[model samples]
Target: MVSKIIALSQGNREYVTDMRRYFHMHPESSLQEFETCKRIQKELTEMGVPFKVVNDIGVIAEIEGAKPGKTVALRGDIDALEITEKTGVPYASTVPGKMHACGHDAHTAMLLGAAKVLWAMKDEFEGTVRLIFQPAEELIAGAKIMIEAGCLEGVDNIFGIHVASAYKVGQVDCTPGPRMASADMMTITVNGVSGHGARPDQCIDAVVITAAIAMNLQTIVSREYSPLDPTVVTIGQMQAGTRANIIANKGTLELSIRSFSPEIRAGLIESIKRVATGTAQALRGTVEFKLTQGTPPTINHEGPTEIARAAAKEIFGEDCLVEREKQTGSEDFAYYSERIPGAMAFIGSAVPGPYVPHHNELFDIDENALPGGMALYVTYALKALAE
Candidate 1:
C-alpha cells in the first residue's frame, strides 16, 4: 500500500510542485485568501473532487472510498507572513510586503497532491479522506473557525505537517508527546502623570516604569519557573512618547508567552500580571494587563504518532525518521488536537547556504521535500484506513 501510494504521489510531482510555486508566487496573508481559495477550488474541481468553501476563505474537500469506514483529516495552513521576498526564485512572492516565508505555500500544495492521489484511488480504500486547506494560520485564527463550522464532525483521526529548515530535506519528525507550546498574547499598558521632561520630581515617568515592568517580567521564566522547563516571554512591541521633549503619560507593551505545560502556562501568565501590576504601583503608576489570542499546546497522541512514524519510515526509510525535542513555537493546529486524536509531522526541506529560518525575509525550502511531504500524507491516510 505504501509503495503504491508513493508511486501515485511521485507521478503527481509536477502538479504538486507547480501548485506550490503558484502559491509562493502569489502569496496571501491571513483570512484574506480569496485568490488562494479560488485556485484551490479550481484545482479540486479539475480533479473531479467534491469540496465546499467555508467562512469565505476555508476549503474542505473530500474523497470517499468504495466502502464506509472511519474518517481521517489532512490539514494544511494557507497563509503567508508579512515579509518581503528576497529569495529571488523565479516563483518568489509577487505580492508586496508578503511572502510564504513559513512554507505554508508548500504545505497547501502537498495536501492538494495527497488529495489528488486519494481521489484517484478512492475506490481502492474503505473510508473518507478529508482535505482541509485552512487559512489564517499565521494569525492563529482559522482552525477554531473551521472547527466551529463542523469541519471535524465525523473525523476519527487527523494529521498535519510543517516544513523544517533545521533538518535535511526528506527527514521526518513525528514524535509523540507535547510537540508544540501554547501561545498567549498579552498587552500591558502603563499609565503615568503627564508633565515636562525637565521636571523630574513633578510627575511619574512611564518610560522608566515600562522598562522596570519589562525587566521584571523576565523573572517569570528565570527566577520562577524551573530551568529545565521551556518557556518564553517576549515583549515584541512597545510604544510610548510621541516626541522627545515631553514626558509620555501612557505607554503600551505587547508581549507573547509560550509554554508546554498547563501548570507552567498558568504560572507564567499570573506572574507576568503580578510583576507588571506591582512594578506600576511601586513606581506611582497603574497598569492594565490583558491576555488574549491564546491557543493551547499541540499534543500528539501515541496512537496517531505511531501511525505517522510507521508510514514515514515505510515511505522514506529508517534514516528519514528523526526524533526531535519539543518546540517552543506554537501552532493553532492544537485547537483540532484538543478535541480529537491528531498528530503533526515536521518535514525537513533544508537547502545549502546561510540557513534562513521561518518568518525571515530570505526563508526558502528545497523543492525536493515537496513530493516527500505529499507522499507522507498519502501514506498515512492509506495506513489509517486499512482494516
Candidate 2:
C-alpha cells in the first residue's frame, strides 16, 4: 500500500506542491473559509469523489469500495492565523496580518495528495475512507461544527496529524496519550466608578480591581495547584482606561489557561472563578467572567497508537520513530478523538537555520517534510480502510 501511494503521487508532484502554495497565498481564518472550501470542493469534484460541503469552512469526502468493511476518517485543518507572513516566499500570503503559520497549508495538501492516491486504490480496498478538511481549527470551533454537521455519522475509528517543527524531516512522532493540552479562554470584566484623576476618593478605580484579580489569578497556578502537577495560566491581553489620567470605570482581561489533565483543567477553572469573585468583592467592584472551552488533549488510544507505530516503522524504519512529550498547544482535533478511538501524530518540518515555528511572520516549514507527510496521510488512509 505504501509503495502504491508513492507511485500514484510521484507523477503528480508538481500538482500537489502547487496546491499547497496556492492555499498559502490566499489564507482564510476559521468559519470564513469560503474560498478555501471552494477550491477543495472543486478538486474533489474533479476527482469524482463523493463529498458534502458544509456552510462554514468544512468538507467531508467519502470514497467507497465495492465491499464494505471498517469505516475510518482522516482530518486536515484548513485555517490560517492572524499573523502576517514575512517569509517572502513566492507564495507568501497576499492578505496582511493573516498567515498559514500552523502548517495547515501542508496539511491540506497532504490530504489532497492522499485523496488522489486513495481514489486510485479505492477499488482494490474493501471499505470507505472519509477525508475531512476542517475549518476554524485556529478559532477552536471547526471540529465541533463538523461533528454537529454529522461528519462522524458512521465512523468507526479516526486519526489526524499535525506538522511539527521539533522533529527533523523524515521522522514522525507519536505518543499513546496526552499529546496536547486543553486550552480554556477566560475574559474578566471589572466595573467601577469613573471620576477626575485629581479626586482620589471620588471614584472607584476599575484598573485597581483588574490588576488585583490578574495578580491573584497568577497565584492559582503557582501556589494553589499541587506542586507535582503542571498548570499554566497566561493573561494574553488587558485593556482599561484609554488615557493615562482618566480613572476608567471598566477594565477587561483576556486570558488562557491550559493543563494536560482534565481534572486539573476543571480545578483551575473553578479556582479562577473563586479568585475573580473574591478579588472583585474586595475591590468593591463587579466582575463579569466569560470563559470558552477549547480542545481537550489529543489523547491517543493504546490500540490505535500501536497500529500507527507499526505503520510508521514500515516507512521510516524502527529507529525513525519517536515519542514526543505532551504539548500545551491545543488542537480542535480533540473533538473527533473524544467521540471515537483514534491517534494524532506529529510529522517534523523543523529545518536548519532561522525558521519561525508557527504564526510568525518569518515562520517557514521544510519542504522535505512534504513527501513524508504525504506518505503518512495516504498510508493512514489505506491502513484505516483495510482495518
Candidate 3:
C-alpha cells in the first residue's frame, strides 16, 4: 500500500518541489501564520478542495471521496521558531531571527504533497480526509486552539509525522505507546540585598543563592522522583548581577521539565517549587515561581500504530522500521492525538555531514527525507480509512 502511494506521489515531483520551495521562502510563526494560510488556501483552491480557516490562522481542508468510510485527519504545524537563518543555503529562511529549524517547513510541504496524492486517489478510497494546517505548535497550544476551532469535529482518526535526524535517511522509529514525553516549563527568581564589593559580608548575594538553588533543583528530581522513570530538569537560562564591584541584588532561573509519566512530572514540579522556595529562605532572600503546562506524552493508538507499521513494511520492506526507545522530547501533535485516536511518527533525514544539534546555528536536514514523509502521510490515512 505504501509503495503504491509513494510511486503515485513521486510522479507529481514537480508540484511537490514547488510547494516545498514556496513554503520555505515565506515562513510564519505561531498564530501569526496569516500569509502562510493564504498560500495553503490558494493551493487547496487550485485542487478544487474545500477547507475552513480558524483560530484566525489555521486551516482544515476537506476532500471527499466517491465512497463512504471513516474520516481521518492529517496534521502539519504551520509555525516557525525564533531561531535565525544561519544555514546559508539559498532556500534558507528569509525572515530575520526566525527560521524553520524544527522542520515545520518540511511538514507543511509534505502534508500538501499528501493532500495532492489523497485528492487524486479519492475515487479509489472511501470517506473524508482532513488536512490540518495548524499554528502555534511550537508554543504547544496550537492543537488545543485548532480543536476549539472544531478541526476534529467529525474526524475518526488523526495522523502526524516529524522529520527525524536520530537515524540515517529512510529510517522510521515509533512505538505503539509513549512515543514522546510530557513537556512543561518552569521559572524561578530570587531577590537579595545589594552592597558594595568592599563590604561583601553586608550583602546577601543573589548570584550565590541562584547557584545553590540551581544545584538543589537537580537533587530534588534525582532524589525525589522515581529513578525508574525518565524525568529531565534542565535550567536553560540564568541571569544575575550587574558589575563585578557590586553584589548582585537579584537573580533568575528558567528551566524545562520533561517526563513520560504525569505522576512523575507532578512530583518533580512539587519538589522543584519547594526546593526553590526553601533555598531562597535559607539564603535570606525571597523567591518567585512560574511554570507553564505543556503537551502530554504522545501515545500512538494501538489501531493506528498497526496500520502505520504495516504501511512502513510495504514501503521499506520491513527492515527500515525500528521499534526504538521512547523520547523525552515533546511534540504538540500529542495534543491532537490525545483528543483523537491517531499515530505520530518520525522519518529519518540524517545525511553524512557535520551533525549540528537541533536549535544549533548550523543544523540541516537531508532533502531525501521529504518524499518519505509525504508518502507515509498518504499511506497511513488510506490504510486507516480502508479499515
Candidate 4:
C-alpha cells in the first residue's frame, strides 16, 4: 500500500507542482479567495471528485470507499499572506501586496494531490476521506467558519500538514501534544484630559499613562507567570500624540498574547486587565481593556498522532521523523482538532539556501517536498480509517 501511494504521489508530482505554481502566481488574501476557490473546484471537477462549497469560500470534497467505515478528514488552508513577492521565481505572485508567503499554495496543491490519490484508491479503503480546502486561515477564522458550516459533522479523525522551510526536504515533525500556542488579541486604551503641551499640571497626559501601562503589562509574563511556562505578551502597535508639541488625551496599545496552557492563558488575560487598569488609575487616567479571543492551542491527540507517526515511518523512513520544540506560532487548525481526534504534521520543504521563515516576502519551499507531503496525507487517511 505504501509503495503504491508513493508511486501515485510521484506520478502526480508535476500536476501538484503546476497547481501550486498557479495558485502562487495568483494569490489571494483571507476570506477573499474567489478565484482560488473556483480554480480548486475546477481541478476537483477535472479529477471527477464531488465537492460542495461552504461559507461561500471553503471547499469540502468527499471520497467514499467501496465499503462503509469510519470517516477521516484532511485539511489544507488556501489563504495567502498580505506580503509582496520577492522570491524572484518565474512563478512569483502577480498580485501586488499579496503572496503565498506561508506556503498555503503548496498545502492546497498537496491536498489536491492527496484527493486524486484517494479517489483513485477509494475501492481499496473501507471508509470516507474528506478533503477540506479551507480559506481565511491567515485570519484564524476559516476553520471555525467551516466547523460551524458542518465540515466536521461526520469526521472520525482529522489530519493536517504544514510546510516548514527550516528543516531539510525529507524531514517530518509529528510530535504530539501542544505543538502550537493559542493566540488572542488585546487592546488597551487610555483616556485623559487633553491640554496644552506647555501646561504643567493641567493635562493628565494619556501618552505617559499608556507608556506606563505597556511597561506594567510586561510584569504579567515576567513576574506573574512561571518562567518554565511558554508565554509571550507583545505590544505590536502603539498610538499616542499626533504631534510632539501637543499633549495627547488618547492612547492605544494593540497586543498579541501567546501561551500553551489554558490556565496560564486565562491568568495572563486577567493580569493584563488588572495591570492596565491599575496603572491608568494610579496615573489619574482611565483605561478600556478589550480582548478578542482567538484560536486555542493546537493539541495533537495521542491516538491520531501515533497513526501519523506510523504513516510517516512507512511512507518515508524512521530517519525522516524529527523532534521539534513546541512553537509559540498559532494555527487555526486547532479549531478542528479541539472537536475531534486530529493531528497536524510539519513537512520539511527547505531549499538549498539560508532559511527564511513564514510570512516573509522571500519565503519559499522546495518543490521536491510536495510528493512526500502528498503521500503523507494519503497514507495517514488510509491508516487512520483502518484503525
Residue-pair clashes per candidate, as listed?
0, 0, 0, 0
> For this target, which candidate reaches the highest lDDT against the unseen true structure?
4
TM per candidate comes to 0.91, 0.88, 0.86, 0.94
Candidate 3 wrongly placed segments (more than 4 Å)? 1-3, 83-90, 94-97, 190-212, 238-251, 280-287, 360-363
What are the lDDT figures for the candidates, one per model? 0.90, 0.84, 0.83, 0.93
Candidate 2 residue lDDT tens string, 1-387: 677766676766777788889999999987889999999999999999989988847899998876898788889999998987888888899988888898998899888887888888777888888889999998888999899988888998887888887788767787797778899899998999998888848888998888898899889988888876667899999888877778889999999988878888889889988998899889888898898888877788886777677777766677878776687888888888888988988888886886556777787688767766777777776776666
Residue pairs that clash (backbone atoms under 3 angstroms), model 4: none
TM-score of 3: 0.86
Cα-based lDDT at residue 202, candidate 3 = 98
- Candidate 2 at residue 340, lDDT? 91
Q: Which stretches of candidate 4 lie over 4 Å from their true place?
A: 196-203, 241-248
Which candidate do you rate higher for lDDT, 1 or 4? 4
Q: Estimate the overall C-alpha local distance difference test score of candidate 4.
A: 0.93
Tell me how far the alpha carbon of residue 319 in candidate 2 is from the true structure, in angstroms, after superposition.
Answer: 1.5
Cα RMSD (angstroms) for every candidate in the order listed: 2.5, 2.8, 3.2, 1.9
Q: 227-246, model 4: which lDDT tens digit per residue?
A: 88889999999999888778
Model 1 C-alpha lDDT per residue in residues 1-387, reported as the tens digit of each score:
777888988898899989999999999889899999999999999999999998779999999999999899999999998899898888888999999999999999999999888988898999999989999998889999899878899999899999999889878999998989999989999999878888958988898899889888877788888888889999999888777777878999999899987788888888988899999999999999788957899999888889999999988898888988898888999999999999999988998777888899889999889888999998898788773
